[model samples]
Target: MTSTNDSNKAAPRKSGPSRRGAMKTIAGAAAALVAAPYIRPASAAPTALRALMWEAYAVRDVIGAFEEKHKVKFAPTFFDGNSEAYNKLRVGGTKDFDLVQADGFWPSLYFREKLIRDMDYAKIPGTANYFPAFKPDAFPLLKDETSGVFFGVPFCWGSYGITYNVGEVPVEKAKSLELLFSPDYSGRLATNARFEENIALAGIMVAHRMGTIDKPRPDGKSFNPYKLTDEELDGVEKLLIEQKPLLLTRYQDAATLEQLLVSGAIVAAPEFAQVYRLMLEKKAKGELDITVDHTLKPKEGGLGWVDTWLISSGVTDAEKADICHAFIDTMIKPETMVQIGKASGCSTTIDIRLLSSAEDQVLYLMNRTDELRGMYMFDQPSSTEKWERVWSRVQAA
Candidate 1:
């Protein structure tokens, strides 16, 4: 995600400029209302509701109809990264914002720290329409085991995989992370600037080499790529050091990566689905002639994330709480998800019903649930400070 603070951020839409980029309007307020069971028309809803979320969710199309329907103002602040949003809430306290959006594992941290409130699944009835994979049983971190309550609701998700220019890299080669490190693609390759993902990507190969990629952690859960042991961390650092010189650049923004891909300066990189979509947009405009495709089921399995909406513990008023639930419910509605999916082109919505066309499903990998099952969801490492030091050393190396 590009920093909201950057001056060179992507240009916004003329209709409604967001904090970072164009804010496309979401259609079908009537459809959303029809699907939403918890929402009740308000004669005098709260004057304003505050949110701290990704820039994508702050657009008028997403909240405009809800605002118009309930007669409430939507006040949102955007963050480029989850840690930024989490730290802001920690410093400012939950009272500063009514609702917050976080990625896969942060909600668990919020729950552990009591930064967010447990929400009743009954209030957000639209969740019932979500794909079965999104249920609490599949992602236990978002739900409390004892209370059977949810700390957050997932809105959009996608995987971080090897994105390659199909014209240059063959499909079979692109199906593995090994392509990124190939000597032929060395100077023609790039990687994400974020170290955590880099670590995970490298760790996957290292774990596999050590024949421990499938081994469960002490908790008996799936193997955690982020929570590397000292030996694994050393292996990851060595892998990154070896990978450092074989790059055109380490990109921090999607625009830079897109330009590199379109210009053919780089043949491939580890990137999110959104970057590939942006490249497609460029392709549509006759900006590039090359075909592009991302590895959906990389040999190491891709690193993925689900961004979710969580209400702050500070929202004590029943009326305000209900409004937050309504907002979440509106976001998960099939019609709303479709519009959001179209506008973003990167993040996949949680509802499979919105994907009626086989083309849409295949293009977005919406029908590939088994592949998603093989993915490693992004999460906080057991020792973030340790990871940071390792990352710093790799960069300095």
Candidate 2:
């Protein structure tokens, strides 16, 4: 999982002085612009195509290959989460980026909001290489079917599951979601403190204990996870409030949680494939003993997320289309996909034969591709909103 240190951090100041100081700062502005040749006017395209995406995705060799194939240079930017990217591009109103990598769950919303453009699939031959189930329009939970029609192409996908330090908790015993809140595991369990993940995990656990499928109410207006009659949500609030004391730490980044596990400060935590791989690496080096539990509780569920490549609707340049397609094609090459899988610790929708045997297993489990196609894609807005509220309560409590 990705995390941001401070969502509220202010954006960097532009190279020039603020309006109030413009007259007095003329000399300073001249020096600033001269010092930073890389900072260009908002309307001007650089010699290269600019991209914003998850960290480590733009490996130098991969980028070099794309630039060589397309005959265009690339300027890459990195962000840890989709929300961060969206906020920066949207609120900042800077349109220099030609393409961006966004979490799949939000692209439809982004499309609806006119923040991104529909992709021209004909330009991206690699679209055919994606799993049929992962086609842009194939996400079952999305409300707008047309929004999936090539707005983005798959980058990577993974499941949210639990990872534990094997020296602290045996693999067999660590396979239950209940361990997250169990008193016995208090002071040992860690969870993603981000609103979305924390809420989704909490909702799944609540749904499991209440023995409900967690459907939107009959009217399709809201989720009734507990069959909660407002009164029971209050109880849930109290229960979650009581359990807060047991947690070791509520974290947002998988890397930080992995470190906590390695240090033995946290025995088990709800995490993704990256966390598991880090644990495996540590164990292999004899620095730690860790194991992942793929079969956590709520037999019917786990969280699954898809990341995709999208061209910003904000960009009107036709040149961007060619550049974006080249980037997508380069990314989908079997070798490139494998590298992405290795770096991101997630599975790509591309063919699996190209991946190492061990990585193939990791990808399979991460996507949970075989279990059922539409099992855990959390795309419903109301459900997401409820989850946010529930998670915030968990954090506050």
Candidate 3:
């Protein structure tokens, strides 16, 4: 099986304006207009907060709540993936936004590169309510234990698994990752275009089926089943290459993949739990016939992911401290978290009792700690390049 522990870093691309750059420009202009001390200072207008995040996450109700409570308008931009968001920010320049929703693993790279500013915790009183594990300090970025200093706040989290169409693959036979890359269903298979999670899933499946484990370096910290060895890598590579002729398309978005599945053009694909839930809904309505399954990959581990909210370093200290905190508080409320979970079709770290009956399944899957730990976080920087190479070969075939 392909090892999921490969590097998680994407090759930094020159994307666009960062939040910091935008703030600096605004600050410079404001400073230029200032006169003598005797002159009364102009009261700053309430700033319009702009955010770039997942489409479902930028809910109008959530933004409206913040706007009404804080008396500031919020404008949000949406992106399908973190890399797209990062690239937009890099190329667009910093002045375009006040906040960016990022995954936990990618924020470390952004923080190290100074793409975002350390948050002013004092203003955001809501930071206190977060679970310790979700704290930015818990990540590798902040080496110290300062309570309020953070680059991001926890947003939502979900796990990776094979989401197959039951109409195509029977339950008993489809209970493993093997079905995803099996030659029998190659031309009908679909996969996410996102490199990290896709590659990790592929790696784990390849490693396990080959009877090998790919161990972490040095201290040998590793997960169950075991790691993949050199021979296993070769075998996994061959398996993936052979299966290439069967793939229908390299999906870059879930909506498209879901639509394809609904149309019966694709049989089985590796995807987030959210997509599976949607498929389940369609199946229930009789508009589609499908089965949602989370097969256990015995040897190869699954992929794990976390989403977070980060304050733009460029925002005023006063705004960052107060508004950001308020936002966090608003999101963590049991009712609010439930709404978020239901709308996004993903489980969150917050307690699930707060959610409605509709969200029970998603909440259950997300909170499965034992199952979650078995999945791999996309923390490796080199994995993307490697996956791209593999993907190219797959496409070429």
Which one wins on lDDT?
Answer: 1
Which 10 consecutive residues of model 2 have the lowest summed lDDT? Answer: 223-232
Model 1 spans > 4 angstroms off: 1-45, 136-139, 216-221, 281-287, 352-356
Provide the lowest-lDDT 10-residue window in model 1. 19-28
C-alpha lDDT of residue 85 in model 2: 80
Estimated TM-score per prediction? 0.84, 0.76, 0.74
Across residues 108-129, which tens digit of lDDT does each residue of candidate 3 receive? 6666656667765555455554
Worst 10 residues of 3 by lDDT: 1-10
Ranking by TM-score: 1, 2, 3
| Residue 318, candidate 2: C-alpha displacement in angstroms | 1.6
Model 2, residue 28: what's the lDDT? 86
Cα error, residue 96 of model 1, in Å, equals 1.1
Global lDDT of model 1: 0.80
Alpha-carbon local distance difference test for all models: 0.80, 0.66, 0.64
Candidate 1: clashing pairs of residues? 12-22, 13-22, 26-61
**lDDT at residue 357 of model 3 (Cα atoms):** 66
Which sections of candidate 3 miss by over 4 Å? 1-45, 91-93, 120-149, 209-238, 285-287, 296-299, 358-367, 383-390
